[model samples]
Every structure is written in C-alpha cells, then in structure tokens.
Target chain A: ELKVEQNPLFLSMQEGKNYTIYCNYSTTSDRLYWYRQDPGKSLESLFVLLSNGAVKQEGRLMASLDTKARLSTLHITAAVHDLSATYFCAVDPYNAGNMLTFGGGTRLMVKP
Target chain B: SAVISQKPSRDICQRGTSLTIQCQVDSQVTMMFWYRQQPGQSLTLIATANQGSEATYESGFVIDKFPISRPNLTFSTLTVSNMSPEDSSIYLCSVGRTDTQYFGPGTRLTVL
Candidate 1:
C-alpha cells in the first residue's frame, strides 16, 4: 500500500508564529502537491513540487520537495487567522498515472 | 487553472435515498475526477471520469455504490446510492487538463 504520512496532525499557533508541516511518502514519487481547504469548502491549490530541491512560495507559504528523502514540507511564516485550515499533501507515484494519493492532512489553527 | 463548479453546495438527505451531484468545468478538460472527504480527513479519490467512457473507480470504491457519468469533456455527475450517515462527507469535482488539476467548490452531503 502506498501511504502518505503527515506529521503534527493538528497545530495551534499565535499570530506571527512559524511552523513547518512535514509529509513523508512510502513510495517513490516525483510530483507532490499541497492544498488548503476551509471548513465546508473545497480544496485550493497551494503548491506543486515536481522534483527534488523543487521549492515554490506564495505570500507566507512555502513548499519544498526532497524526492531522494521521499519527503515534502509546507512552511508557514508569520501565520495569520486566514491561514487557518486543513492542509493536505498529495503524492503522485512515478508510475501511478495521473491519480493522486493524499495524506491524512494537517489541521492548522492560527490565533491572533 | 480551470474553474470547476459543483451543484447543491450542501444538502441534507435521508437514508435509503439517493443523491446526484453535478460537476461542471468552465472549459473542456481531458479528465474529470470525483473525491470524497470525510470529517477531518484527507480527500480520497473515488474515481476518474472519462468522456464517453465508463469511470475507473478506486480500490475501495465501487460503481454500484458510487455511479459516475461523464457525458462530455466538461461535465460529469456522481450518484450516491442507498445513502447512509457513513456516506456523509464533502464531494469534490476536479478538472485535469494540460497536466494540472483544479478543484470545484464541493458539495456537502449530510445523510441522516
């Protein structure tokens, strides 16, 4: 079974705090994606890391992929209440066609 | 990124009944997918809907429980049969074109 595991399933932070969510996969994959979903809402694309050392950043959110380590990270800087949501990391195994296998997700709660 | 939309943002249904959720994309896409997100859980791929062809379901999902239809390149429907409270979740539609996937707003289903 191909499994994607994420650390810190739940996190609470104060404004201006920083944290990093880690995603580790059991299989070899070259493409990883980060997504955010609010309560009762659908997913919003965050970042797509396609290769080792691939890093993408938008605003205060940054995502990086280390294929050799079979890991990816989503780093939050200067957290805000608006960033409070569930974050998921999806891994696409090199041979899994275009389907995505998602992790259990990390729930983030940013407080002022 | 394609704009995807799902009908019936939220609904309350009784058990033993069925509900059909519609997904529409702003532009024609090569592939459409359906996913389910249980409470506080990550998104799980239900199946991949291909235009003019039968859907390919995941390992745990079956066509009888979740029937999918893709009439064209930009529209699809997923029907949940004999609903139960265990089937309560948010159903999302995603569009895949040019190697990227974008999600719809989702349909929240509450089976009682």
Candidate 2:
C-alpha cells in the first residue's frame, strides 16, 4: 500500500511569514498533486508536479517534487490571511490509473 | 480541465436513512472517482466509477454501504445507505482529464 505523510499538520503563522509543508510518500511515484480546502468547501487544485525536480508556483505558493526521494514540498512564501486552509498532497501510484492516495493534510492558520 | 457539478450541495439526514448524491461532468470522461473527506481530515478515495462497468471500491469500503452507478461517461451517482453519524462527511466526485483530475464542489452529508 502507498502511504503519504505530511508534516506540520497544524501550522499557525502570522501574515507575511513563510512556511513549507512537506509531503513524503512510502512508495515510488512520479505524479504528485497539492490541493487546498476551506472549512466547509471542497478541494481546490493547487499544483501538479509530474516529474523529478518539477516545480510550480501560484501567487505565494510554490510546489516541487523529488521523485527519486519519493517526496514533495509545498512552500509558502510571505503568506497572507487568505492562504489559511487545509493543504493536502496526493500521490498517484505507478500504473494506478489516477487512483490517488492523499496525505493527512496540513491545516494552515495565517493570523493577520 | 473538466467542469463538474454535484446536486444537493448539502443535506441533513436521520440515522438509517439513505441519500443519493449525483455527479455530472460537462464532458465525457473515462475515469470518475468518488472521495470522502471527514471533518478536519484528508480526502479518502471511496471508489472508482468507470463507464459501462462495475465500480471499484477501495479497502474499508463496500458496495453495500456505498453503491455507485455509472450510467454513462458524463454522469455517475453514489448512494449512501444506512447513514449514521459516523457517515457525516463531505463527498466529492472528480474526473480525470488528460494528466490532471478536477474535483466537483462536493456534497456535505450530515447524519443525525
């Protein structure tokens, strides 16, 4: 079974601060995805990291994948209050045909 | 990216009752997935709904508890049977497009 683990499950940071969420998988996989979900809303796609060393950035959030190490990272640079939400990283196991195993998720709280 | 929609955005039901959630995509998709997210938790794959075939459920889930129907490529439905307070969660449907998957708005089910 493929397992995905994320660190700092609960993050509390002030606005303008920076933080990074790490996603580590137990199996070898090349496709990783990051999603954000509000308290009562569904998930919103954040980034899709497909290859080793692949990196994507949107606004103050940056996500990168290291397939060789079976790890991915979502870095938040100069966060804002609106960035406070639960972040999840999902891994698609090899030949799984898009079946995703998601991490525990990191709940971010950005205080103004 | 495929646009998806779910009916009955949120509902409150009594224990032992059943609820059917509908998922529709704007375009035909080969792979549609059902996921459940408990409060303050990450998303868990419930099953894979493929057109013209029986749904593939993940471990810890069964067709008797959550029956899924894929009548066509653009539509699917999930019926939660014998609901209980433990079943209260957000149910989301997603479709695979190209290399990425898009999620629906989600249906929140609250069992009393």
Candidate 3:
C-alpha cells in the first residue's frame, strides 16, 4: 500500500520566519506535486517535482524531491500572512493507472 | 498548462438529494480525476474517467453511488447520488496531461 505522511499538521509561524514541511511516501514515485488551498477554496498548484534532485522555486516557496529516499520537502522563506493556507503533497505511485496518494495537509498560519 | 473550472461553486442541499458537479478543461485531456476532500481531512480520489472507457472507481467508491460521465476529452461530470451529510465535502476535478495534473476550483457541498 502507498501512504504519504506529513509532519507538523498545524503550524503557526511569524512573518519573516523560515520553515519547512516534510512529506514522506512509502513507495517510489517520480511525480510529486505540491498544492496550496485557502479556506473554503480549491487547490492551487505550486510545484511539480518529477525527478530526483529536482528543485523548483517560485517567489518565497521552494520544493524539492528525492526519489531515492521517497521524500519531498517544501520550504517556505520569508513567510507572509498572505501565504497562510493548507499545503498538500501528493505522489503518483508508479501504478499502471497512475493513481495519486495524498498526504494529510499541513495547515500553516502566518502571524503578522 | 490546463485551466480547469467547476460549476456551482457551492450548494446547500437537503439529505437524500443528489447533486451533479460539472468539470470543464480548457484543452483536451487524456484522463480526468475526481477527488473528495472532507472536512478536516485530506483528499481521497473517487474515480478516474477516460473519454471512451468506463470510469475506474477507487476502493470505497462505486459507480452507482458516484456515477461519472466523460462526454468528451475536455468535459466530465460527477454526480453524488442520494447524498447525506457525510457526502458534504469539496469535490475537485483534475485533468492529467503528461505527468502533472491541474485541479479545478472545486464544488463545495453542504448537506443539510
């Protein structure tokens, strides 16, 4: 069975602080995606890490994947209150149909 | 990149009523996925719909309960039949092109 686990399910940090959310998957997969969802809203795509050692950054957020270790990290730099939302990491297991197993999201609240 | 949209951003329905959610993608896609996010929980994929094939439902989902129709390459519909309070959730639709998937805004349902 494939499972994705995320730590620090609820996070509260001050603006300008740096933090990282870790996602660990039980199976090997090359496609890992990160999404952000605000309250009562749908998901917004943030990153799509497709290979080992693949790192992508956009503005204040950066995401990296390590296929060998079956882990991914989402790093937030200079966190702002506007960045407060739930972050979810999903891995598409190398199944024949390519189904995704999602991690329990990490809800971050950035303080002013 | 694919731009996805869902109809009836939100609805409040009574128990035993059924609701249909429509998903539209800006471009043709090979596979469309439907997911449900319950309150305070992660997402669970309901099914995968292909243009000319019967939808493949996940473990806990069935065709009779959540019937899906893929009329074309860029459009699909998911109906929550005989809904109860437990069916109240955010229903999201995604289109997979290549390896990455793009999600629609989602339909928020409130079953009373």
Candidate 4:
C-alpha cells in the first residue's frame, strides 16, 4: 500500500511570512500534485510535479518533487490572508491508473 | 484542464436514504474518480470510474455501498446507499488530464 504523509497538519502564520509543507510517500512515484481546499469547497488544483526535480509555481506558491526521495514540498512565499486554507499533496502510484493517494493535509491560517 | 460540474451542491438527508451525485465534464475523459472528505479530514479515493467498465473501488470501499456508473466518457454518477451520520461528508468527482486532475465543485452530504 502507498502511504502519503504530510507535516505540520495545522499551521498558523502571520501575513507576509513564508512556510513550507512537506509531503512524503512510502512508494516510488514520480507523479505528484498539490491542491488547496477552502472551507466547504472542493479542491483547487495548485501544481502538478511530474518528475524528479520538477518544480511548478503559481503566484506565491511553489511546489517541487523529488522522486528519488519519495518526497514533495509546497512552498508558500510571502503568504497573504487569501492563502489561508487547507493544502493537500497527492501521489499517483505507478500504474495506478491515475488514482491518487492523498496526504493528511496541512491547514494553514494566515493572520492579517 | 477540464471543466467539471456536480449536482445538488449540498444536501441534508435522512438515514437509510440514498443520494446520487451527478458529475459532468466539458470534455471526454478516460478515467474519472470519486473522492470523499470527511469533516476536518483529508481526501480519500473512493473509486475509479472508467468508461465502458465497472468502477474500480479502493480498499475499505465496496461497490454495493457506493455504486458508480460511467455511462460515457463525459459523465458519471455515484450513489451513496444506506446513508448514515458517518457517511456525511463532501463527495467530489474528478477527471485526469495530462498530469493534473481537475475536480468538481463537490457535493456536501449531511446524513442525519
């Protein structure tokens, strides 16, 4: 079974601060994804890291994947109030037909 | 990215009743997925719905309890049978394209 784990399940940071959420998987997989979910809302796609050393950034959020280490990271730079939400990292196991195993999620609270 | 929509954005249902959530995509997709997110929890893959085949369920899930239908490539339905308080959660449908999976708005089911 593929297990995905995330750190700092709950984070409280002031606006303009920076933080990083870590995601680690038990198995070897190159396809990883980052998603954000607001309260009572569905997930919003953040980034798709397909291979080792692949990094994707949008706005103040950047995501990177290290396949060899079975790890991924979502970096928040200069966070804002709007960045306060639950972030999730998912991993698609090899030949899993795109089925994703998600992490425990990191709930971020950005105080203004 | 694929545009997806789900019906009955949120509902409060009585125990033992069944609710069928519909998922529609703007374009055809080979694989569609159903996920469940309980309150204050992370996402869990319920099943994988593929066009022209029986839906593949994940561990701890069964087709009899959560029946899925993938009539075509652009649409699918997930029926929650014999609902209970434990089954109250946010159900989301997703479609994979390239390296990313786009999700629907989600259906919040509250069983009492």
The 10-residue segment with the lowest total lDDT in model 2 chain B: B94-103
Mark the regions of model 1 whose C-alpha exceeds 4 Å error after superposition: A94-97
All-Cα superposition RMSD per candidate: 1.4, 1.1, 1.5, 1.2
Q: Tens digits of per-residue lDDT for model 2 on B57-105?
A: 9999999999999999999999999999999999999987777778999
Error (Å) of candidate 1 at residue A103 is 1.0
**By summed lDDT, which 10 consecutive residues of candidate 4 chain A come out lowest?**
A91-100
Candidate 3 docks with a DockQ of 0.57
Cα error, candidate 1, residue B65 (Å): 0.9
Model 2, DockQ value? 0.68
User: Where in model 4 is the C-alpha error above 4 Å?
Assistant: A95-97
Give candidate 2's whole-model lDDT.
0.92
Q: 1 or 2, which is superior by TM-score?
A: 2
Task: Return the candidate ranking by DockQ, descending.
Answer: 4, 2, 1, 3
Task: lDDT winner between 1 and 2, please give it.
Answer: 2
TM-score, prediction 4: 0.96
**lDDT tens readout by residue for model 1, B18-47:** 999999999887678899988778889999
Residue range A1-112, candidate 2, lDDT tens digits = 8889999899999999999999999998889999998888887888888889999999999999999999899999999999999999999996343788999999999999
What shift in Å separates residue A18 of candidate 4 from its native position after superposition?
1.7
Q: What DockQ would candidate 1 receive versus the native complex?
A: 0.60
* TM-score, per-candidate, Cα-based: 0.95, 0.97, 0.95, 0.96
Against the reference, the lDDT scores of all candidates come to: 0.89, 0.92, 0.91, 0.92
1 against 3, candidate with superior lDDT: 3
